[model samples]
Target chain A: MPVYNARIIVTLRSSILDPEGTAIEHALHELTYTSCTNVRVGKYITMNVEAESEENAREILDQACRKLLANQVMEDYSYTLEETEREPA
Target chain B: MPVYNARIIVTLRSSILDPEGTAIEHALHELTYTSCTNVRVGKYITMNVEAESEENAREILDQACRKLLANQVMEDYSYTLEETEREPA
Candidate 1:
């Protein structure tokens, strides 16, 4: 079985108000950190899973996102999966 | 000035309801991804900053978390900073 690494990102829909992001930006200005901008709040989920193939992993991950991971009405999600690194002998 | 990389994680305070995480868990079960459990939703923010010292970076990050990045009533946050990686010749 091949081990797959997945990075899942979930963010509030554009229509939603992200008080968290807004607050962080304000604090940055107060600290004299002017270079930071466009702060957004979202989830970054890293998962390692065993799967027979990439297609199978994608199928399973999609199901997870739609059913358990993201809310259709208020949140949007995207994910990327890569094969696990192998150690050199 | 040294460049610092910060990873900010924001989670819903225990008292808050996380429908988003709940939904993701439910979806995972349906997709036959049984190994995953205790799924939670949070933000992972990556920032590259130029700071004179670690203390200064911490102060700014803290201010950002309080004023803009997190909701005190419902959210909590933690951050870690490491010096940026240098390119190898």
Candidate 2:
């Protein structure tokens, strides 16, 4: 079986207000990082999967992202998948 | 002034337990993505910074990550910075 590593980024839709983001922006200003703006926060997920092929890996990850990793209603997600060698025990 | 965009990824240290990650992994299994394992979740932050130079931009972002974006004791963070064209009005 081929092992694949997938990195997924899930972010809120632009129209939705992000309270966490707002709080971080305020904290940054208080810390004198005034040059920073439009700060948005999201989720980063890294997972490893054992699959038969690259396409199979992608399909599995896409399904995972849609079904569990992200909320499709208010969040958007993108991911990158790459093959990796299995780790030695 | 130059403007730079930074993407920051902050992940919990391996020594720390990630309940979110465990929950996600269980969800995937229930959803039949049984091959997927070692799922970890973290934070993804995007911000724009206006600065005098590339180094200045990096310094500001580094400070932002340290002071606001991540908890240094339990999380580790890394970022990439790129120059982006200003958004049109």
lDDT of 1 by residue, B7-86 (tens): 78887876887787677666676677964544567777756666788888788778777877778899898888898753
Question: Which docking category, incorrect, acceptable, medium or high, applies to candidate 1?
Answer: incorrect
The Cα error of candidate 1 at residue B85, in Å, is 5.7
Model 2 has how many clashing residue pairs? 0
Query: On residues A1-89, what C-alpha lDDT tens digit does candidate 1 reach at each position?
Result: 67677778878887888787677667777777775554557786656656788888788778777776677788888888898863354
Q: How does the DockQ of candidate 2 come out?
A: 0.92
Enumerate residue pairs that collide in model 1: A23-B67, A23-B68, A24-B68, A24-B69, A67-B27, A68-B23, A68-B24, A68-B27, A69-B24
Error of 2 at A53 (Å): 0.7
What proportion of the true contacts does each candidate reproduce? 0.34, 0.97
Q: Which stretch of 10 consecutive residues in model 1 chain B shows the poorest summed lDDT?
A: B34-43
The C-alpha lDDT values of all candidates are 0.73, 0.90
- Candidate 2 lDDT over B7-86, as tens digits, reads 99999999999999999999889888899999899999998899998999988877777877789999999999899897
The numbered model that scores best in DockQ is: 2
